[model samples]
Target: MAVRPPQQDGDEPDTLEFGIAALSPHLSKSDLTFPATTDEVVRELGDPAIPYDANGNTVRLSEALGAVRATQFDTQRELLDALHPVLEEYRESGGGILSQLRALLPF
Candidate 1:
């Protein structure tokens, strides 16, 4: 999905987009769903790639979040909630040219 930053002074803002990995359709049903915990995600995804800090030391997910004063949620609803702000930002960015053109139509 793509999201443009808020417009300013009638000028368009830069567009930002994120990628999400989808499971292959050919995969068996057993590999399609995730377990009900973050720990399971770690096991399934095989240990998230650790990022390095300014000091060149690897940082864990919690440590990275802590550095930015942020935290992660594990529950489904909570996970969606955590993503809400970003969704809102994209919503506010308005649809692209197609949407604007559609608005100009009387039908």
Candidate 2:
């Protein structure tokens, strides 16, 4: 059965599909803690590890002048920063992923 929105007296029920950002009006969305510079990203990401090569070896990427890279991929902040733009794009396209993601954001 199709779900129905809550109704008010003499008023039309809100039926517009809102993206995660819109739905999460109470959520704290900020990038104040994110890496602003690519250097910061690389530093935060840390050195890459090699399988079965635990000699404190660090992987280096070719200089891309202005790129963000970080070894802290497991952190919620990093993940959020990386996915925020993509989520925003989806949200703009009226895709459902943004809403789903918004519900799970600030992880």
Candidate 3:
């Protein structure tokens, strides 16, 4: 996704958008729903080329959230990481332009 930082005058940033992978192995038989898994979520929306400070390290949401709660970093990267997949899912499920625009807003 094109993640634009907040503007100086407190206005919204330019659009940030990206594609998510299809729900494949995670899909269930009933209605083809996929259980939200960290790996699947990350794989679908993560920027593989982007460098992570922890390098090859990976962890589940619970673990990541725990770390965040403990103030591992001043801010939580996991929140941003988690939002991408959800936004992708909403877009793919036929969310309109307004909805997409809302999703692009910084938290």
TM-score of each candidate? 0.26, 0.25, 0.23
**How do the residues 13-67 of candidate 1 rate in per-residue lDDT, one tens digit apiece?**
3653331111111112233243234444334444332312111122232322233
Best by TM-score: 1
Off by over 4 Å in 3: 2-74, 96-107
- The most accurate candidate by lDDT is 3
Among all windows of ten consecutive residues in candidate 3, which has the lowest summed lDDT?
49-58
Model 1 residue 37 lDDT score: 45
Q: Please, what is the whole-model Cα lDDT of each candidate in the order they appear?
A: 0.35, 0.35, 0.36
Q: Which stretches of candidate 1 lie over 4 Å from their true place?
A: 1-74
What does candidate 3's lDDT look like per residue over 1-107, in tens digits? 34454456656536332321112112222232134344443444442422111111122333333323232222224444444454444335534475456658896
Number of colliding residue pairs in each model: 0, 4, 0
